[model samples]
Target chain A: MEALGVNLPFLLVQIVNLIIVYTVITKWIVGPIMGLLEKRRETISKGLEDARVAAEARANAEKEAAKIIADAQAEASKVVREATERAESAGKDVRAAAEAEAAKAREAAMAEAELERNRILGDLRGQVAALAIAAANKLVGEALDEKKQRALIDEFFSGVKSGKVVVVGESLSGDAAEVTSALPLTSEEQDVVKKNISAKEYAFKVDPSIMGGLVIKVGDKVLDASVAGKLEGLRSTLK
Target chain B: MKRVWARWVVLAAIILGLFLFTGFFGIGLGIKPIMPHVYLPGEKLSETPLFGIAGLYPTNTLVGLLLADIVVILIAIGVSRGVKSGKTVLTGISGAVEALLEMLHGITEGTAGKWTKQIFPWFATITLLVLAANWSGLIPGNETVGLIHHYDHGYDLKQVGPITTIWDEGTDDGEHHGEYAIVPFLRPVSTDLNFTFALAIVAVVMIQVFGFRSQGLGYLTKFWNTKTLFSKPIFGVIDFGVGILELVSEISKVLSFAFRLFGNMFAGAVLLFVIGSLVPVFAQSMFYLLEFFIGLIQAIVFGMLTMVFMSQATQGHGEHHEEAH
Candidate 1:
């Protein structure tokens, strides 16, 4: 009556309306939206799982590639080492073959020199005997016999100097040392001694079949005055 | 059939109880003024007319009707609660009542569904309550209280005819002077403008509430409804005039709701009173029947108008006007 102030009925109506609207919307709209959000959450989780699996697969592939590369590198290194070792061994084999061939060539040269020396010694022996008989006949004015000459040669060899000398004969006795005459020492000889003498001396035996010549050696220096040596010098000059 | 008879018996018993209560209070008591008259605030209770307005005022009948309306609405809600979704007594009543309300709501909601839902409950409740209050006054003895008379001047007196006065005025011969009296036995609620004005204020305030709830503070601008008033000078002037008009219209709603119901019910009561006074027996019965129908029709009209005005106030003016057209 007093201008119809706020009343219980109006308040009740407002409250009732609010409740009805809230209930209906909660049942219909909000519930459906919540369901949609739940589905979206599941989808996102499945997507995350798929991404994780893909990442793992990619990592495995990378590891396998790395392993293959490592294996290839190891194999390549082993091949290089084997090839290098084979090349080194081939070089060593070539060196060994060359040395053997040089040794055989040196032995053949030494045998050939020995055979030539014997043939020259045979010719020199005949010349030296003839020259000795002529020299005796000139000195005594009479011919001497071969036996007596042989005995005299022995006596002269035995009476010569006991130093190193060269004997030119088919065969030299262990005691043979004689020469036709003792030669004077020349300036050349002294020079040879100064130039060629070594601090340590070595003795060398020459098998010379030229019996009339005397050969003397001191270290590497040699003096030869024999029929074979004279005939080799003559042939060299004529040619 | 028994259930129907039982319901009628209960209704009759309640009616009888209300009648007996009224009769005991109305007829058994003999006061100095046998008929109760009211002195409104700022109104004199003398037999002399004040500014040509009636001197004898009635009790505030609107208060009782308002109280009864509240009780009726509460009972209606309780009864409706017993109703299930599609089946129940209230649902059947609602099916009949809702046909017209639904049609009105459809029109309001055609363009303003969003706003109407906010105000529909208050609008429907107010309409139904006011309607029930108005119609209840059509019952017998509602406007038929016995008549009594007071002295044209301000004195108590002894009785002159069959009507006995309880108080006397001094006489010239040292004897008491007697005065004639007339009194009635019933009164109707709506016959008073105060009751109708109260109802009108409730209806108008409810319209404002719906408007505010629907559109918030913007609803105040409905009185000043204009587009680009400042930009176009001539249209601005017209808009200003229209704003004044809108204000006048809102002021007129108080007069409209109050006077319409008051005039109708008062006229009906006066017609019945005149006819029954002229021909006591048959005219009383005939006019009583006429009053009953008039009361029902007026209640329906008042409720329907409240509903329409409230819906219109809350809804978009352009759409509703177009739909009305």
Candidate 2:
């Protein structure tokens, strides 16, 4: 060992020096660097986690917003559909009501026209009878009274109400008959017409434009015999 | 294939050119031819009385050891200062120190496990000190520049002048030319057995301390297993004999560790001297590189050995053997 210069004091000193270096390096250098690296890594990971959470929240919020918009759209469409259906139904009801009212007004106007035509026809017949009486007086030297004229017109209407005017004989077995005339038929005349027609059900109408005609309709058949009807028939025969 | 051959040709040409230049052109340029200077272990430049004491003197190796310590301490101080400055990232020399310490931590931790934190200091110290001491010789003036002493036909202590004036020329160049040898003020620290042995002793002592700490008094059973003797007589004798061998191995560890560092560093120094003498110029550079790696390897080997021994010592003999298997 002496040949190798193994001195105790110097070895001790070297050992001491080494220990000192190790202590300083460990305490001052390694400790701080390790800590810094660990801290930086942790901070980075935490930031990443926070970013991920924020992105997830954003996605969730977007989904919720989309759902609300979709829900609102569905609700709005449902409301519009209901409103459109309600408006269309109301228009249909109004159309139906208007058609019915127009039909009723047309029927009333027709009834009034028939009444006026019947009055006019009655006046013309009275005039024609007066003229005929005057001419007869001139020819035979006599005057016709009002009571006799009324009896002649009533006799003519009785023949039509009893269905005797019908050219083609028809079976009168139906439960109902339709009666049409130029003048309004009174309740007594309607009963007489019903008794003569021998039908329990009856429909009566007046159209003065027909010129003193009585038309009877039962099922698909019709009988017409009046002054206007005979004149149309003579005209058609002349043509 | 053509490109690869071209690259190889270029590499070969460069190598040949380097060899030719160092062999022929280098010498022709008047580079001085250096003679290998012979040196003995513990040779000193000069001896000075310790604190002016008449008979007490400090050896030159002691001065070298002190120089190594001062350098290491200054580095430690510099590193400490860098750390104290509170910089987030180490740079330059402090960075190197931190890297070295970090590497040491990896090595020691692998062997020592939990006790790495406790034993890493000693391991770092030995490695750094040995590495620094070994590398110190590569510097320009180490073991080269110092005072010169002149002696006549026969040299004697009484024939020399006062300690301070040892460099002074006492006699002129006359009929008899006295031979002289240089005594450098500083030598590489690892070349001194005293420094290496001191570090080894410290390392071995710490191993025992760790062993005691880990296994308590039971650690001594590795050196002497008295309980095994009565239980199994035949196996007990073998166990007892093995214990004695273990004790001798422990003592031998210090000597071997010391000599291992001393031998490598001392041989590296001689190699540098011989190479420097033979071609005094560019030739020494390659050897310097070799010495550099040698220094690094020796430092690693010494430190790792200490760590391994400390780790092994901490475990009981049976457990250590089992682990070895």
Candidate 3:
């Protein structure tokens, strides 16, 4: 130990010097450096946490934006569909109204045509009565009163009423004409009417609606000799 | 970027040119044979009056130790100054100091755990101080430039270096200029057993203190457990014997810690000296690098061993013994 220069006092002094160094190093160096490192670590960790939170917020905002866009699209489609349905129903109403108006006008025209035909028939009846009277005067060589004219026409129409209208295809000797008139017919007038219309049985009929017209009937067939009948045939042919 | 690379190439070329120039010229390399110095008291560089007291002066190794202390203190002050003022970022020398302390702290913390806070100062102190002392020896004039000494028969030479001085070449006339040795102004502090032994004493003492603090008076039972001896004689005898062995080992720790650092550092210094003398050129440079590594390793070993011993001292010896089994 002596040869190695292990001085006792110097060793103690070195130990003391080391203790002082230790004291100084611990107080000033290690303590502050460790604290700084810890602080930096905390700052870094906090920054990372803030970044995480910001990223989460961004994601949430994106989600909300997507939802709003989806809702707007859905609302737009619903509005479009509702508008289409309304337009369809409105078009249907318009078509139905136009069709109803056309039907109404057709019915009115038909009624007017019927009324004109009836009026024409009434005018023709008066003329036919005058003509029949003139014919009777010439054929029988008699002046007939209002009652006699009615009797003469009735006798002629009685023959037509008994199914005595002769058909063109059948034999005229077996068929007879039954005439209807507004007035009575005389026996001579009846003979004249019979000579004009062939029949197996002669019958005469009177109707006030016919005024002075003559109508002959044979089975289901009817022949109009009156002015009213001639006018009705003329109106049917015009239609 | 091209400019920066060109600058680097220019700088490297300059360095290579300087190296080649110096290598050829032998401008700095000392080609003399660097003999190993014994682990004895260094030759005196100067003598102080000390109020007329005898044998009061600074030896070469003592000057070296003081110089090492100054360097360490400067480094410590540099490291502490900015940190003391609460600065967050450090740079340059302070940064290096902080890095070294942090690394040492990490290693010590693993071995010492919570006790590291209490023990780290001593650990760091020994390491940095020893590291400085060890590296100080590698400087150009550490054991080279100093006072010249002449051996005399009338004077007690044993008080200085080894009685057998290699540089001594006695003349026929016995003139003082006949045989002499260069007593350098500085020698590495760790080359002296005193420094290593002192540090070891400090470490071992602290360990004992930690043991007492942790386990109370019961900590001494590991050295002499009479209670076990009375209960189980056969096993107790072995236990007591092991306890004595443990005590011996504890004492031996001081010697071990001292010799381990001293031997490694002292050997490295001698090797560098011898290699520098023999090969001198690039060969000594490689040894310098090796010495630097050895110095660093020796410092770490000293500090880590202290920390380990302190940690073990705080624990129960029985548990440690069981673990060993």
Which TM-score value belongs to model 2?
A: 0.59
The per-model lDDT (C-alpha) reads 0.52, 0.69, 0.71
Of the candidates shown, which would achieve the greatest TM-score relative to the real structure? 3
lDDT string for model 2 (A1-239, tens) is 55655545545555676566567655654555455445656878999999999999999999999999999999999999999999999999999999999999999999898767766865665565566556766886665565674544543443343434332244454577888766555566667666566666898876655656577777776777655787889999999
lDDT of 1 by residue, B156-195 (tens): 5445587544453334564435343334333444655555
Candidate 2, residue A26: Cα displacement in angstroms equals 6.0
Q: Estimate, for each residue in A123-184, the C-alpha lDDT of model 1 and write its tens digit.
A: 55446556777798899998888777754542232212222222332323322232222222
Give the CAPRI class of candidate 2. Answer: incorrect
lDDT of 3 by residue, A1-239 (tens): 65666666667667777777677666666666677667767879999999999999999999999999999999999999999989888888887888788888888987787556545654654465678888878997978896768554544433333233222234334365666755555456567667665677887765656644577686657766665666777899999
What are the runs in model 1 whose C-alpha is more than 4 Å off? Answer: A1-239, B1-63, B70-74, B77-81, B84-87, B91-118, B146-186, B225-227, B318-325
Q: Candidate 3 — which residues are off by over 4 angstroms?
A: A44-52, A55-59, A72-239, B1-39, B49-56, B84-89, B151-178, B319-325
Model 3 residue A56 lDDT score:
100
List the TM values for chain B, per candidate.
0.60, 0.79, 0.79
Query: Which sections of candidate 2 miss by over 4 Å?
Result: A8-239, B1-29, B52-67, B82-88, B151-181, B318-325
Give candidate 3's error at residue B192 in angstroms: 1.5
As a whole number from 0 to 100, the lDDT of residue B56 in candidate 2 is 33
What is the full ranking by DockQ, best candidate first?
A: 3, 2, 1
**What fraction of the genuine interface contacts, i.e. the true contacts, does candidate 1 reproduce?**
0.00
